[model samples]
Target: MTRGDDYVLGRGLADSVRLDAQHLLWKMHKGYELHPLIPRTDNMKIAEIGTGTGIWLFDIARQLPSSVQLHGFDISDNQYPSKELWPKNVSLGLLNSLIDPPAHLVGQYDVVHLRMWVPNIRGNDTSALIQHVKSLLKPGGYIQWEDADLVHQYVKGPKAQEFERRINKIFDKAGLDFRWVSDIPDRLTEKGFLVLESESGRFELDSIQECTKTYLLVLREYINGFKKLPDLDIQQMAKEEEIALDQLYLQYSHGIVYNWSPVSLLGRRDD
Candidate 1:
């Protein structure tokens, strides 16, 4: 995979800082995300899927009491914080959730959490993935997953529209439909988990939203990564983005409507 695809925004300190900022936005919108979803986790074991940089897990780890354990797993540990730097209760592992997880990891965690992993996981195979996550949890354990609906991402004005169209093309080529994230609640039900309802909020990457610049940075990464793909037409995409860049300049300067809302669902495995 290209370096551009390494951390979805390049594995750099700048990307890490941007992610931290984005985390604040999510926290502000979604709170800690787990407290309301699950009943408790005082001495519970927790695992995070697709843990990039492991920043979110680290933050949650710090808040958690000493008895609790926080684990994060991903295909790449390139951006993970040094072990020496991690809290004693927090750990990072190199594991891909899409593949068959190791037998030893089965039924280990009291909570299995995944956030913002829509770009990588296939919509058609989400059910199987959730089932696997369920396996990682103890009886009646909680699964708190959060992801945004991108298939219906909205942008206003012709200028913003053009920018979104190009980005959408790249996502389409990648076969990414993060909207399936919204269906996790139902999927958990089908998998025999007790669906626990909760609240969520929308994220608008426009002139008004605070994280617009962060979203722009991510868009740039997509442009760079898609350019390297063998099948996608880089020339056409770049040309469209050229116009889009100018359009975005004007759109974000004034006011534009670009909405990307997220949902957080809770599921409990039957004992």
Candidate 2:
């Protein structure tokens, strides 16, 4: 696979990783809960940063009783749905978070929600991005962030731990902090948000076999991204890891469970 194709595959795999039963329960109970509290009115303006597939935005709009105005911003246009299925209240905008918010969007939203932004946040100067998010929020508005503490993957098992360590080390070497989720709430607070709530959940399966097939497909794509490296030892190790991951997938297909952990941080922009 080419680099672009590999990247697309990685994104697709990550998105396909479903929120299991427990997550569905929380999502249902929470009304797709927003941190710092849900907006009091359906007419509130909402902005979703890095809306993966626009599914969440569409669902939220469908749930609201009033005419909610929604905007989704992403670097990739891939997240948008077909025009025929688009909601009347929703619009899609191309945005590069590393840069300033577009002139049209400044101080325009009531809720600014950002999820799974770890990759971009780690790749760029997050302080600037945080400030940009802040600027986009209206006074007393809220910003919710959902990300994972990837380093916690190390605690899952020997193989998983090693994988987590290696991935994080690579990210660190690339000037990205893979563990940024652990500090995001505090960072938001420092950025002037009143942290209302922060919680984390873990997903543990009986074995990697439980989720191996799905996981391997993802791994194959991710590995492709690094296949161009010149280091012989690294390439050899990656090959071995790929084999192991594939084996785990086989086991999962038979009936095994894999564990994952994700976190949610919600806060309000102080008036």
**Alpha-carbon local distance difference test for all models:** 0.70, 0.62
**Candidate closest to the true structure, highest TM-score:** 1
TM, every model: 0.86, 0.78
- Clash pairs (backbone) in predicted model 1: none
**Top model number, lDDT:** 1
lDDT of 2 by residue, 245-271 (tens): 665555544444444346787788885
Give the C-alpha miss distance for residue 270 in model 2, angstroms: 1.2
The digit string of per-residue lDDT tens for model 1 on 106-210 reads: 999998988776656654458657767888999989888777666655566776676777677767766556666667777788888888764455664332265
Q: So what's the TM-score on candidate 2?
A: 0.78
Sequence-dependent TM-score of model 1: 0.86
* Candidate 2 Cα lDDT to native: 0.62
Residue runs of model 2 more than 4 Å from their true location after superposition? 1-36, 123-125, 154-176, 204-220, 228-237, 253-258
